[model samples]
Target: MRRLLLFLLFMVTTGAIAVFSVQNATAVSLRFLAWQSIQLPLGVLLVLVAVLALWIPYIASAGR
Candidate 1:
């Protein structure tokens, strides 16, 4: 229950940030592995990173 509420709060905050970024800028860009990419919003990136962090422990454990 608490976890669900926290997740919902995070989603709402990320959505708000995305909307704000879109309204203020033409687009956001990101660079990775010597490659350049665009299209995804900052809010989406934030959420993705958060999810990746959450999965890191499980992924590391699976290696064993």
Candidate 2:
């Protein structure tokens, strides 16, 4: 029963994230340096940043 509740919670949270990502995807752009730019969905950028952040901590700690 507890596991089922947790699973439902996870599903709801993920669904919310998906909906938010889809909505924001169309309204984002990136600017780098002067006179350089590219357009991308916010969700893609966020996922890339998240992956980098998660990996950095693990990589840094691995050497210790």
lDDT leader? 1
Clashing pairs in 1: none
Q: Report the alpha-carbon TM-score of model 1 versus the true structure.
A: 0.50
**Candidate 2 lDDT over residue span 13-55, tens digit each:** 6687678778886746666666644676777777666679779
In candidate 2, stretches whose alpha carbon ends up further than 4 angstroms from where it belongs are 1-14, 27-37
**Runs off by more than 4 Å, candidate 1:** 1-26
Quick one: how many clashes does candidate 1 have? Answer: 0
Q: Residue-wise lDDT of candidate 1 within 1-64, one digit each (tens)?
A: 9999999998998788778656665456778889987677666666577789889999999999
lDDT of each: 0.77, 0.76
